[model samples]
Target chain A: MTLERAVAPAQRAVDILGGDVSESALKGYLEGLPGVDAVGLEQRAAGLGTRSIKTSSKAWALDRIIELIDLTTLEGADTPGKVRSLVAKALVPDASDLTTPRVAAVCVYGDMVPHAVEALGAAHGDPDQGLVSVAAVATAFPSGRASRAVKLADTRDAVAAGADEIDMVIDRGAFLSGRWGQVFDEIVAVKDACRKADGGYAHLKVILETGELNTYDNVRRASVLAILAGGDFIKTSTGKVSPAATLPVTLLMLETVRDWHRWTGEKIGVKPAGGIRTSKDAIKYLVTVAETLGEEWLVPHLFRYGASSLLNDVLLQRQKLTTGRYSGPSYVTID
Target chain B: MTRLTVPKTYKLYLGGKFPRSESGRTYEVATPAGEFLANASLASRKDARDAVVAARGATGGWAGATAYNRGQVLYRVAEVLEGRHAQFVDEIVAQEGVSRAAATAQVDEAIDRWVWYAGWCDKYAQVAGNANPVAGPYFNISAPEPTGVVAVIAPQDSSLLGLVSAVAPALVTGNTVVVVASERFPLSAISLGEVLATSDVPGGVVNVLTGSPAEIAPWLASHQDVDALDLVGAGELDWPALEQAAAESVTRVSWPEQGPDAATPSIERIRAFTETKTVWHTKSLL
Candidate 1:
């Protein structure tokens, strides 16, 4: 177990950014990423949403949506019982149907990681084993308002507790104030903190909290900056913000990821977590993903939904497709 | 110059707001003589489901209100119905193709019957519930509670009066209703929705869907969230099948076995949508 094998990916990030890594250089590069045509980008995303994916395609999309969900419960009232039930749901989303696909991960607060991990049990380790992975939101989530030491410690403790992925929030204060190097350094530091004792690194998802980032241009720049800092995923919001995950913002992030893949041949994940509640809305996101990044990004590793209630809606739709009857809230679990 | 007519676009009244059918389907409404009138929204099964959702949302506010407060709201509905008297008469005339006198009689009876039922909102609980003398050393009492969201298939033949008679009694008991209006004569029902909207009855407490009950009733009957199915207006359809569907979900079925109800409203209609709970209390407090 050597640090060099683990630090290879970290070294590549520095090489890709050309080794200068100064505040002004990062600012110059981020400021130079083309300005977004807000109206056109929104119109394109809207146009893509109108493409109907129905019947067998819709049925397939529902199962894929289930697999892509990071079934989340980040409420202040979240308890161990709630996290356990959330994981239970992630394992067999619809208890009525054993064939229902398990969700990609169960996302919770960092402190709740061990509980989710313990609840997952033998089904915890590998997606290939039809298991649900545990994802924890770290670095003073929702609001990234803590010191770098505390944020790193938060990341390390959750990784130590068996969290497969860490969802970290970037410092919007630094990013909005044009402190690109600080934002870049923090993500890189958090990514470094994700290293486990066995020389493995937990997946690092950087939440932009796009609702706080006023313009699409800023979202685009933050997205590219996070990728340059070696984020495995660039998440749209913390779900605590209004306008958490809109189609247009996710579309822009997907485009950034697409371009990054074209230039550097690396595919970064995109997660739109908050307001998407229905199967129809989730299908539209799938359509956007396929059209923007080719079907390659549709997998759980490259795309995910940071959601809780969205899972129930997908289950209801799945039940409708299977039974040819409509379902209600009574049909699904309360969590 | 003669004034041009501006026809009203009839939409489904769901959650107190008027929205077009989810399917965007509308059917032509004509006098029984085959003359054309306005087009009314043809509510689909999904519309019935949406109405059920709306009714479920309003159940808390309507059922939790004090009996006296519910009485006040029902009285307010009667007040609004009275203000819209001429409109109802015209709608009934157009819908049933009956003479003004006949339509007026029906409208008057509907208004009067509604008021009569409204008066019972606070009293039916007392009439349907009572204290019992038991052998144990305890005070035993029984009281009726609303059975939650009720889906009504309003009687198709007696347009205005039947609709009022069927819906008012359920409202009297503080059970929110999602009613499918008389299919052939739905203009008055949609107009009644306007009256309920302004009467403080709350939006979802009385959702009105204007469409074929045959298509909509089955969905409502089978819906798991719907507590009871009132097939009072569903006698014309394959009501036996609706009852079967309701039976599958164990929903309380309200089928008027004797056919068309009596001329006046009955307290039994209110009791049908209530569950009586009996509780025993110790004789002394510690």
Candidate 2:
């Protein structure tokens, strides 16, 4: 499908939002979104980070954390074997402990989606019981520097190659340069390209690359713009930036989604990717979501962590809680 | 005109930094004659747990360092001790009610003990390891490796010398230590922390906590992350209960010797916190 065929749904969102869908109108809508209080946001995030969840509650959080993880491997050297191993890990995070929950998805680059899909299919004999989605990072991935047509084709290729979800990065340059319409149109076009022949569309997570956006104001603005442009999920970063997925940034994004739901009655998902490596950190993010939004956002459909090493730490901690003994990294796979 | 003397606050040394106890509790330490010395930070169980975490974090890098480098680091500790010799003597004299000469001798002996361990760092592995000859076409060897994090209870008496004796062996073998300083006399131990921080020793390699061993020993003995416990300072406390608690994790426990020989430096102290791994590989002609 081309960009023209995908215009109707986006045009409806623009129409409902009471805007002309022009650059100035889109800019005004984003700018009029509430600004973030930097110090207050950080203090609240840090305060919530100290809320201790122990024992049974911790165990429950670990299981939910595993289920909400987008187990990602986005290196240039990813191969079929690597993707297969990652898929196996995603399917049975702890082979020794059968009660472990399967992850939400096996995320990979666009070219590796087929391998992940095939591996997941072979492992999950009962599709309903162990259904793991495959997510591909498209739209030039970590860099989002490609032309619109190429980015659209990237999204289309992944969806055609068995990707149940497409993670597209927004043009940070355009978003920062006040070109709100271009950024919004790119997301709408990518969301359109996720369309399948059977009228089903892949879930779209728009990456705002909050690290490069420079301010909490821009992060809040981008969150509203992505939601208005029809993002199924608003992701914090591409895992390639330095200050990716910080607590305050995720808190701001969570508040944005909460307010957006309140205003439009449409619930969008939030995924904070990168630098979240420990079970404690994952639980903190979960606490933020539950406290900022409600218990409804604690499910896999509403929240996710785009992490790779986080699984091993979570597994190690979970095993410790189960066996009543400390575990080392040797017991877990190092992928 | 009189000049006011500024006294020091004895704080816990955790991960090579002086931090007040998270519990924000402090207790007063007095000389044997009941003269006031200084207020010491009364470390809590949480402080002990944090020290273990710091010690565990430093174990990998400390153990991976070359034996020569560890030797150099230990020697650096001795050098720093010598530089602070006068302060240690003064504190020892004030805390222990000993003669100034006896205090000086204790300070010197503590410094020499560090030198002794410094020399043994590169040599203990050879003394403790062996090459076993098997009746098969294989090469078999057993070598000692540092057993992760260790928790120590510094002796109640012989504060400076005893503290050095318990801490040096574990650290020279590349194992990180969380030591509960002598309950009655903790000032010298905190001063030693100043010496250690100035030395080349890495942060978390040797953490000193000033508090009751009875209060903190149970936590360290049962801590899942601690690999071993040296109950040299248990004194009149119940040893069997600590041993039983330590059994939860199968932590290696070493009790202090009852006689004068407890002050002696030996490779046995070093071996108490090391694991000997023997490997066999088939020798074949290709």
Candidate 3:
């Protein structure tokens, strides 16, 4: 076809032989084409997945998302001393010296907020210089299957121990059981508990564990529910499930936050966790927030990433910006 | 002969049982039949709150149901209404003082309208939208999704038809509805619930509460749990007051228009229930 020859002169020979060829057969024939980037092909073959991303002229924003590495784990119990020490060490990188800043935050079990506070404090030398404040998941935490009394108590203890922010999981079981009132009451109660903490309140973040909610609409609804329940933040997962922090789920969450802010004049935050390890993965979230909610939410309080391995990639990109090439990086130490 | 007369009572409908309004209060819903069809309970602000809780609790699983399943469930709503068509006709005939034939037609139209919306459940996404045109290299698309936990005030006069018309669009999009049907025509609305109950539509997906709109609308409007509202049937509402109340949580208020011709609602009526999202995607070359 003249059209094919005009578009891709190199493929003119194939066009001469294949004017009537079907696309599928052509695809098979073209499989043998040389110099095709397999990664590009793989990405193309992955199918259309829906999500929103913010546009930017500065490559640094993209670089920041695609390259920054974060080290975070919500596994196991946490202690005040252990968490504090980890915070201290992560702030000071040795050797490999990944030149980027440390991860956004160190997420831990609720009871370890005090330890995280101490660790973050000691690491910074001055309280304000630390890499991250503790993200203490509370309100019966991972399971979210407990009495309101127990959940509220958990939230109280976490915030009292100095959690910079508290992550509370909704009772999906209750939500699924058609007990929205109970779910609403529990979220509201926990948020109230977070506000009543000893040294003022830590930010209340509600984790919907969207994987369990099944559909995007449910996730959106849960986002609205969490924000209405007074959550300062709505998060994607507890990282205890299969299929965590997906693009579709995050897209729905971003829409909810944008819509909630439109309706209520309040800005609720979004935090995506579980399995986001690459700089590319982090950038997707940044782009998502920027485009969907507008550029105002690019900061940590409004937007955060629940990642452990993403910081180094961010550093790699940042270093490339300062120098000209991606260089050797170090694992930032964490107390 | 012990005066052989009985006092009427109204109650709350919860989990399929009618108990005294949790607030233990009753208000009058006088019928043109010169009798009360059970003195409807004055559902207190507390009771409205309870109903919201019930609907919210039921929303997750109901929303998770497959579109096909939801469609079938909605079709069953029509089927149930068909069987009880006479009851709805009688209520409409009495309340609106329309001819029996007209009442029957209204009931028939209400049932058919539900079926129309039912088919839309699996198909609106295709019609409303598909994907984004991203200017950078990435994958994307946008779909019309349900805004969960909608609060509806059913049209006052066209009780059965208006109630179904308001609720069908919301549910078809996968959102759960908590409705405050016409206070005067609560009978047919409650009767519709019977249809919803037997039709296999999940409980709480369509909750019908009978109470004073002025009294309960404020609670529903201001409550954070309610995502959007239909003020369509709010007759004599203090607009500024309702507006202020709706402002609290920014509940989407679709102000009631002039009573819809129950015979035919335009496509725009149906389209109003839908949302549009435009996505723009492009590849980045470094």
DockQ of 2: 0.26
Please report, as a residue range, the 10-residue window in candidate 1 chain A with the lowest summed lDDT: A1-10
Please state the i-RMS of candidate 2. Answer: 4.2
Task: Give lDDT per model, in order.
Answer: 0.87, 0.87, 0.66
Worst 10 residues of 2 chain A by lDDT: A1-10
State which candidate, 2 or 3, has the greater lDDT. 2
lDDT of 2 by residue, A1-335 (tens): 11222223475456656657888877777777667789999999999999978799999999889989999999999999999999989989998798999998889999998898789875532223457888899999989889999999999999999787789999999988888888888888888898876676777889999999999999999888888787888999999998989999999999999987887677788999999999889999999999999998876667889999999999988987898655556568988
Instruction: List, residue by residue over A13-120, the lDDT tens digit for candidate 3.
Output: 234335533334433433332332435433432322323333343356744442222246565654556565556545643334444345556677876666666666
What is the TM-score ranking, best to worst? 1, 2, 3
* Model 2 regions lying over 4 Å from their true place: A1-12, A17-19, A50-60, A94-100, A122-131, A315-335, B3-5, B33-36, B131-142, B235-238, B244-250, B277-286
Residue-level lDDT of model 1, residues A255-308, one tens digit each, is 999999898777788999999999889999999999999897888778999888
Q: DockQ, in order, for the candidates?
A: 0.57, 0.26, 0.00
Flag regions of model 1 displaced more than 4 Å. Answer: A1-13, B134-139, B256-264, B280-283
Q: What is the C-alpha local distance difference test score of candidate 3? A: 0.66
How well is each residue in B1-286 modelled by candidate 2, as lDDT tens digits?
Answer: 9999999988999998999999999999999988788999999987987898799899999999999999999999999899988989999989999999999998898899999999999998898888889998888989899998999988888779999999999987789999999899999998989888988899999999998888888878767778899988785678778888888778899986554456478878899999998999788956
Compare candidates 1 and 3 on lDDT and give the better one: 1
